[model samples]
Target chain A: MTDLLRVVDPGLYTTVQDLGRPHAISSGVPPGGAMDRFAHSAANLLVGNDIGAATLECTLIGPRLVAEAPCLVAVTGADCELLINARPAPMWSGIFLSTGDELHFGARRSGARMHIAVSGGVAADRWLGSLSTNVIAGRGGMHGRPLMSGDVIAAVAERSGPGVSGRELDPHLRPDYSNHTLGVIAGPHMKRLDADGRAALLGSTFHVSRDADRMGYRLDGATLRAAGDELLSFGLVAGALQVPGGGQPILLMADHQTAGGYPVVAVVVSASMAIAAQLVPGDEVRFEETTIEAALRVRRERRAALDSLRS
Target chain B: MPPPRSTTRVRIHPLGDTALLAELGTRLDTALNTRAIALAAALKKRRDVRQAVAGYATVTVHFDPDQTTHEALGSAIKRLATKRPPMEEPGRLHRIPVVYDGPDLESVAGALGLQPQAVAEIHTRPIYRVFLVGFVPGWAYLGPLPEELAMPRRDVPRTLVPAGSVAIAGRQTGIYPLATPGGWHLIGRTSVKLFLPDSDPPSLFRAGDRVKFFGVRP
Candidate 1:
């Protein structure tokens, strides 16, 4: 058996994603792809699929799969309930399936987005060197929309002969989505804010508002007053918590626009981004301020962990 | 939170592996933004940096993880922080001809307490520098309009301000690169394509470009 499964149950929101498009920002196009890049990559590697393969960006609920041939698959990122023909399938583990077997993912137990990678990847047309879906522009990834109840996606053609079986990622590599604390690095405007503004930013507890999406996550918390009035328009990136006129902080995410004019309080660090991706609306988030040194150290440790798995 | 400062200081932070996020400073102006962009570019040139990403008042530096740790990269950046150079003078001048006949022209002139011709004269009197490109692709946020000509933005933004529309907000003027929703007061229109996505230099104006306007004949 060379290929994999077809979608029998397309849950809440599932879209295909790869690394994302980078060069399109200057044209008012956002670089959108997988929210959890590390998790996506790990899942792909587990199934022996190429790192850039089109994987499923499953939201609160994941899709159901029916195998058409024997194939290996793995799930990474947030903990979600999984079942095989009504029997439970464990999260964060690799499994094999034969033709006619069924796999279904239930409501999320923790986290927002999950990654499901099959051995040969999802067969979809590539645009701008990625299969990531961009719903705003209505392009790429399964006709630029979320998966529905009855979608049948064909498996991609295999490049390497089917000689390897899927393996599970090291248990330690799994992210703890239940944790609300995230690390951040001080930004250029840190000097602009006064001591109290800075203190309040780090000490406060912010709830992820229901308005959160791939574009950005709006927070409901102690109003964060800007040090100055309006600001000049500048570039924006993911993890930026921009406070506009209302003083509410909005954290930009993977599908964020290339530029913005809101004053940011702090930026989420790289290592904690996977955790950020798992945040759902109403999830509580508290920022644990760290020096640039701490943020970087965290990143290095995470990378080292990932490297060890690959080796 | 402390008593709000009269002038807001926008926060800037490094977003790992991707880009920088510059929290917008208070009263988005041309001068501070110019300093921010140039400083970001300069700060990026120092040791072990990969890319210099600037926005508003914050700049993020992206580097290769294999070459260095994020800690080393951040400390290296903090050491390099310093005052930015004066806004770099524009390399070249672009004289764009604009037809002073937008729908909002009359209201804008009245708000500035000047006749339509006087407003036009004030607009064309001084050459402006292109501070930065943002809001939409190729949109040029041009600057330092004569204080007398400076006007508040329209309470209701146009749903679709045509491409090439010359508009003004408090202390600044700009050319819309494409047809998009805008809140600036429109005074005229131009035919120059400020942004061409397919072109080599997608943006017509860089951070350090100069611009002058002329009254075009229909």
Candidate 2:
């Protein structure tokens, strides 16, 4: 392994994440990974790394790092200004940094999380076959927690020769983090919601409440009245919109619990997950009902876009 | 007594493009749970499936969208369900020792109109089934809690329920593997660690395991 970068200033809640441990979910482990998978993969691709390569997922704020060795790096997700050696640098494209060069982030423009990928991927402790951090379980990633000052980040493999840089993802391929409307499919418990509740789900405009985090986004909107009877607890997936007795709806996210008891009214489609990840507290969001075929088609389209970048 | 054979028809619904939630039944019957667990295990072997998690009476199969579609997976699940896979051998049994000294012991007994000792006696009577393990890492939801001991969850959940605190809520009993906010009525504590991150199969309990709780002096 080659030491690549040193965390000079750990930003707010920065952790190493990749594609995540999907198989571990049966063991009650949450599928904790990069909230914005598209950006995470794009950043990895820009750095000539595999889509599943571990990268830094910075929340709200970004980190300041000093290069320990020559490495290629790329940043994606969140409209944050990048600075290299105190000079402005462009995002969505690969850049090379020499030893002793510093990287910094300035001014959050849009979105909540930013992903940074380095050549050869960031090497860290892995748990359940993943480097993604599950903070609740206190395992995986860097000791199951976010980065701290003075922490040394190493590359999984050493750069053998001069690495390629300046690879850029087409602007059209980038997701619109600004999009507020999300496509959703009706959940099994949709009937539990009263007619008004069902109508509100499609007609209402909700705002992301302050309680938003990796676990879920509690939305502040119309009071949805669902049946009071408690449903049997069941396995929950990210993007499930669960409405509790309180009438408020919560959108489950990447770090959500393995199972839940609340009635899930609808689930956001896979294609809209990146947009959902970019949402911050107080962001306005609306839901639109869509068919299964439409949801799958959009997801396929998104995957095709990513695949296009691969070739 | 072993749970009766599940006679309910299975229903499949779309969780999303990537997953399908199959409901075997509504109530928390052991028979339904067993079938769900069996179905989940069977589905996990499929090349198209990423993971299949069993709930009380449901199995949520997460699949690779590129490899399979909802209709295709739905039919596969139906075909598997029709076979009615025989219940496998009962999982490992755990006889956990617990000291029945908890903050809610008296209150829970009072609510049930029974003595604290009587409540503990009823709580330990049956060999509870581990229906599912979830809500958090290593946290197993066990029961069909005895009808006599059935008590509603506390109206106001505690801000922090200590790890290893054995608690009961509705028809289920569980031990908190981590200190977290909870609403269950805590009636005992266990020395056994349910969560061991470094160990393979980190959780001490798995779905379909058998658990028997016995009272012990502090």
Candidate 3:
């Protein structure tokens, strides 16, 4: 038995996400995992938990969790107003909570999603080798769906233990979702675009369209269509910048389909996936082309930076 | 003599630090799928490579960058392509009892110049091989749809396709395990639970499985 965190209000939309079902995608299962892997890992690392530990992936607004057992908790990603018992609490660091403490998440001050990592990670059922919630399929996570009001999420078997507290991370490493400049590596199908088509994609700024979900970020910007090329449905990677028939581009995200027919112009670099995930509808985004080598180096640096944070 | 017919070659690309894609062929081919399965089998042996997601003509290998680098993973993929794995024995035949009374039964029969019974007979004749399982869970993309019964996807997809709805589109046929918006023509339904989330194996059919759909009145 463990402390049960009863959900008082399951905010705008919340789901449990981790590294996700990477293996399951081949089986036609969408890689339904955390939209922003970097932040998800960081939150767990902050509280001395495994990086892939299942955490509450709070989208926009967050849930009101009433802790039934004393434990340590940390919140990262989109900067939301986090409070414990109506009093403001610090995010990005573990906050020690007593049994029966109510954790309130207010309006989002920054970013579009937030991750709440409880100490020892949350106890959940794993489906097809992952604990990540696939809401579309209604499998995995706590009871295979989003947290509902009065739902009690099981904490680890041993909830009351030595806890890490008040340890904040470096501010420089934290991303500001306000300025969205995503780095990309030009194409699996870059040459398919004509000169103007290329310019339209690279030159103009695109706003994150409302037709956005975990599947992809549909961008509204300069019409960047294919140059009379018939596209065959093939394997797609996360962050693929695809130009569908509509002329507008869609950036495939963490939960993208296994394959698509649209021609890919570019893909957001691995280092900028966190930035891509933070974009809310109406957020302006400028796409910057970078070499694959440079993208790899950036990711290496990001990992090293994160490594230094480990005690 | 003209150059001997060329065999399709596999191409590898770095998707990210954590993954790489091995594009086996430009077009969709069963050979590509075979190669993907072989690559997946080979990569599974590698401690560094975590998973291999085989798609149309490509298999994306997700790896732990900390354990392996892009260059090393690429080399492994290249090495596997040089020496491919032989295809496993064809999957066992599965009898799927389906009711041949779908909303589109008449329309599909009219389009194919066949009676509704003939359509059902054709659908159940050959043991359809499972090319892949995607779009939704428990939804196996079983096909070659027998040339005669094949038709393009409906222009206007239904808003809600009920679970167990057996549908066909293009050259593929599958059952919708859950209610979802789809463009595939619904011909009938089945009673067997194709997907049970809480059970082990979760998915009833794996890639390469063979299925035989039979008409069941009731």
Mind giving the per-residue lDDT tens digits that candidate 1 earns over B155-205?
A: 877889888899999888998877778999888999998875445456777
Real contacts recovered, all predictions = 0.35, 0.75, 0.37
- Answer with 1 or 2, whichever has the higher TM-score: 2
The residue-by-residue lDDT of candidate 2 on B1-218, one tens digit each, is: 99664543778899877888998888888877888889998999999999999999999989998898898999888888878668589899999999999899999999999999998899999999999988888899999898888888899999999999999998899999999999999999999998878876778999999999999999
Residue-level lDDT tens digits of model 1 in A147-257: 776676666866333434445566666656678898876654555567777787788889999989998888998877777656666666678777776778888888886
In what order do the candidates fall by lDDT, top score first?
2, 3, 1
Error of 1 at B39 (Å): 7.7
- For each candidate, the DockQ is 0.27, 0.77, 0.44
The model with the greatest DockQ is 2
Candidate 3 per-residue lDDT, tens place, A1-311, comes to 57558889999888888888766665667777888877888887777777778899988889999988777888888978899999989888778888899998877876788888887887777888888887766778877888899887776545333566887777777655666888887776778888887887788899999988888988998988687545435557788888876788999988787765678778788889988998899889998888767877778876765665577
Model 1 compared with the native: what TM-score? Answer: 0.77
Residue range B88-191, candidate 3, lDDT tens digits: 67777789999999999999999999999998898888888776665566667777678898898898889999899999987779898778888899999998
lDDT of 1 at A37: 77
Error of 2 at B123 (Å): 1.0
